[model samples]
Target: MIVGEQKPIAEIKEMVAPYKKLLVLGCGTCVKTCFAGGEDETAVLASAIRLVSRKEGRTIEVEELTVERQCENEFIQEAAEAVGRNDSVLSLACGAGVQAIARRFVTKPVLPGVNTTFIGVLEKQGLFTEECSGCGNCELALFGAVCPVTRCAKKLLNGPCGGSQAGKCEVNPDTDCAWQMIIERLKILGQLDNLRAYVPPKNWNTSTSGGPRKLVREDHII
Candidate 1:
């Protein structure tokens, strides 16, 4: 899932200060799970903005709405009426979501209220850890499913870096050495021979063609 964090109140206050009627749009899928911009969080944010506006002797009307997702046009269409009524939008979705809303409503100013963090997983309750870099090419087969590209502090493909000590990363002692996890996992699977073959560096340019990357499913399109 895509992980994100909400922007500070001060920054959000500044962005919506100009708009008398601002819409605080929330995304209920990815951002909801991570507790960033869900329906409840959206309401809290709207109230906060109202309080701040009131304190400043201003009458700022904040309308709150949460869509299933801001990326999909199906869900994007759900917020059309609310969006149309507002002077500006403060999207509390991921960067993609914010941009999607902007693209759909070309004339409206879509301000990002959340900072898109990364594609990550929830390790436990309230603990989200980044597990993928979306490097376009996947090489998990070589490392027993432990991704060195994203987990390694230095992003070393052929690693262990000689700096890691006691199964922990040298650069960030708190982090487990990705290579150590790989080797241990491979040993368990009896696939230690996987490391014997020398692997080439990642061909990032192959799939990531330098500009905005996208996929069009011709099967789904009309």
Candidate 2:
């Protein structure tokens, strides 16, 4: 899932200070899971804004709404009426979601409320760890499901860098050496010979280096 963190209240206050009628839009997908921008978060932020505005002797009207998802047009359409009524929108979604809303409502100012962090997984409650870089090409099968591209500090493809010590990464002692984990996993699966096959240099063209990407399913198209 895409992980993100909410902007501080002071910054958000500044962003919406100019608008009298502001809409705090929440996305109930990735940002929800990370506790950044969900229905509950929207309400909290709206109340906070109201409190601050009141203390400053200013009257600000905040409308709060949460869509199933802010990235998809179908879900975004649900907030059309609310969006049209507001002077400006503070989108508490991922960068993609904020852009999607901005694209749909070309005239409205869509302000981002959260900083998009990375593609990662929930390691435990309240702890999310990045696990993928979305390189476009997946090579997990070659490394026993451990992606050296993301886990390795050096992104080494062949073997562990000589600097690894005590099964920990040389770049950061707190991090486990990705190669070490790969080798141990391969040994347990009795597939150590897979390392013998040489992997060519990664083709970065398939990644973000090639610019924005798109996928079309011909079967699902109208």
Candidate achieving the largest lDDT: 2
TM-score of each: 0.96, 0.94
- TM-score, predicted candidate 1 vs. hidden true structure: 0.96
Error of 2 at 151 (Å): 1.6
In order, what lDDT does every prediction score?
0.93, 0.94
Pairs that clash in candidate 1: none
Cα RMSD for candidates in order: 1.2, 1.4
Worst 10 residues of 1 by lDDT: 205-214
**Candidate 2 backbone collisions, by pair:** none
Q: lDDT per residue, candidate 1, 115-147, as tens digits?
A: 999899999999998999888888898899999
Query: What's the residue-level lDDT of 174 in candidate 2?
Result: 86
- lDDT comparing candidate 1 with the true structure: 0.93
